[model samples]
Target: MVKNHSSLLQNKEFQYFIIATTILDLGKKLSWVALSWFVYQITGSALSVGIVISASTISPLIASIIAGGILDSYNRKNIIVIENIIRGLILSLIPILFWIDALDLWSIVVVVSINGMLSSFTNIGSRTILPSLVNKNQLESANAIVSMTSQFGYLIGPSIGGFSVALFGEPMTLFFNVLCFFIAAFLYSLIPTESYQSQNHQKTNVLSTDNRMRKFFFDTKEGMTFLLKFKPVLFIAFITFFFNLTYSPFETMLPIYVKDILLTGPESLGFMWTAFAIGAFLGSLLWVKIKRTFIYSYALGLIIILWGITPTFFVYFSNIYMIYTLMFIGGIVYAPYNIISPTIQQILIPNDKRGRVLGVIGLIGGLGFPIGVYFSGMLAEFLGASTIILGSGVLTILLGICVIIHPSLRFSQMTNLDNIKENL
Candidate 1:
């Protein structure tokens, strides 16, 4: 049955969240092309691109951990709105520096790190807000809407960014991103926090610096204690660690993939991304309808296997159209993992401790990815991008197969949300 997605928009609060997220997605997509091209052009070295991007990845991980305290303690709505404005102002520096031809590599690295950390600081609140905005029955549907809008932006933004670089340059592309963040922030400001149902029951005094630091560590410890008792969360942590570890090398190697293996430019890269987004859009929509009977843990392993095998063929495909088709197919398998993992966290974790628990999940994935990125950079330099990516892909498939046979994951599947809430 075709679900009425329009009804989702009529819920004013969820509507506001979606609008803000969609705007941010557009900016993020534009920045991916514009900034990558700008850095590569300026430095003429793939290793430099790896360093800047790895910094962006690592900084955000650390911020999410630190922001755990803020998400559980402070006024989340106020922080998000203020953070968005700050992020916009910080990002505006890129275009300004580009205009003056004063964009140095180290300066760009610093800007990306600062922006990454602050951006994650704000997003922790928004990420945990979906359960409050929508009814439980509609949670999957709401996540699907989020995915669709985000992919819709990806479908449009990258092509425009890639073309605009040849037309108006990276400065104009970055300028577009600057506008999106500010506008998204305003839309966020309209959300009424009086309606926020999530709250931390424990009180902490933020008055003294020493007490505040102590409080932050205590809050984090409390969340970690709760997480340790839950086996499913640990299951996710295990797979996510391996998943991000294997996935990182491929991500860090993408520029070389598009350039060397595919023998293409940004336009082709844009087309590949558009294909991935379209698949994700449709896959997310499909999951909402099918998630009732879904075996959450089993499906996760299967998705990983599909992801691993698809890329093996992708690297071998000679025709560009064939490569695009494989990328699109890969995206469909990939979308379910993104939707399921977060939805389960939102469902199982207590609203009060959700921030820190999510922070823990972020730390696990983050730790693996940067380590993968660092080694991938060195490995790709010695072994070539093809060998590095292919090795990662094959190992991921084996890991998924091992997960399929594992007693923990096979038995870890939740019977129902009612059972889940009772256990949790």
Candidate 2:
């Protein structure tokens, strides 16, 4: 890890990339809290939370499929820079509309929908660029660092956003969000050109004008084809889908649970999320210590199961501190997967197909999130959030157990590329 950090810092380009990513992540985290609060404040309905999230979901799903192709067809650095600029401008509008008293629910939805589309493009550009920035052996460390940074953002951004919402109202919080984006954009400008490649840099389109979409589909097909050849990668993606599904209700409806059932206000609800973020950040740091251990998957499964089940108990008990403790405890297991999953992929996948395969993983992962959020929300309306969350835990535990029963799906003791290849 030290060696990886040294190399990452020694590379001037990567230094800039780190700054850019860290800053952008800050904005991303803050916007998450800000938007959710904005929606809840405006609509005061639980289902409205689902509607707000749908804004992000609809466009990103469509854009993510295309983003993989774009990743393969463009200069990734340019894409990153451009996307940030666009996102900055778009997000700025939110504050402007709010200040003008013209910000309606529909307007917020429209802006966020655009935000999601741009985010897909931005995510693809950045994720694909990582392999090019660092040595293959260091990919795991680099990914770990990135995951850690993200958790750090989660740690700080929501707390700050919550405070901002309380002190300055939602519009000013959004205005600060715009500033964060520009800061990210400026940092992105400092990254060197050597760190990235244009996928089809000089190649002209060979497909007929009408066949462009067909060609795009065929390109996406290549990513799916690669994953189809790898069982571990497929299993991981499948497990991630279910695991993510289990976690979605917390993000989408947990605030409502805190507010309605537990009688906690927005500030207190934000603190609960902050508690989750703190756990996640600490958990991310722990990845550096146990990264080589064989118990990684088992630990992850246990933590996730806790994530699902703990809320059930907390909701009934209505003890905020207990819920907060569980949230933090859950974080310990939560953060490593972010580190390990990407690490597993980097080790397992060749550079040639990493973009496409990761894109497919993103697509599959993406599908699970909205499905989880929407379904859990609907279920909460029919049953209760506690049942939906608890059931999700049970489902995740069962899924992991099933995967473990298949020896092939179990985590291997392999460490490096040679062992990974031999194991696979």
Give the winner by TM-score: 1
**In candidate 2, what are the lDDT values of residues 1-424, reduced to their tens digit?**
7777777778876777777777676677677777887888788766778777866776777677677776665566677778878888998888898777898888988898898898886676677778787887777778877877776666777778778878888778777778877777777667676565644533414556557666567767887887887777776787787777766776787767777777776666667767877887777767675546565456555555555565556545677788778777777657777776777776786655566677787777777778877877777778876666667667766755655455444554536435646755
| TM-scores of the models, in the order given | 0.92, 0.90
Question: Every model's Cα RMSD, please?
Answer: 2.4, 2.8
- The reply for model 1, stretches above 4 Å from the true place, is 1-7, 201-212, 291-294, 411-421
lDDT by residue (285-325, candidate 1, tens digit) is 77766734545556888889988987677567768899789
Quote the positional error of residue 293 for candidate 1 in Å: 2.5
Name the lDDT of candidate 2: 0.71
Q: In candidate 1, residue 328 scores what lDDT?
A: 88
In candidate 1, position 161 carries an lDDT of: 80
Clashes in model 1: which pairs? none
Minimum summed lDDT over a 10-residue window in model 2 is located at 198-207
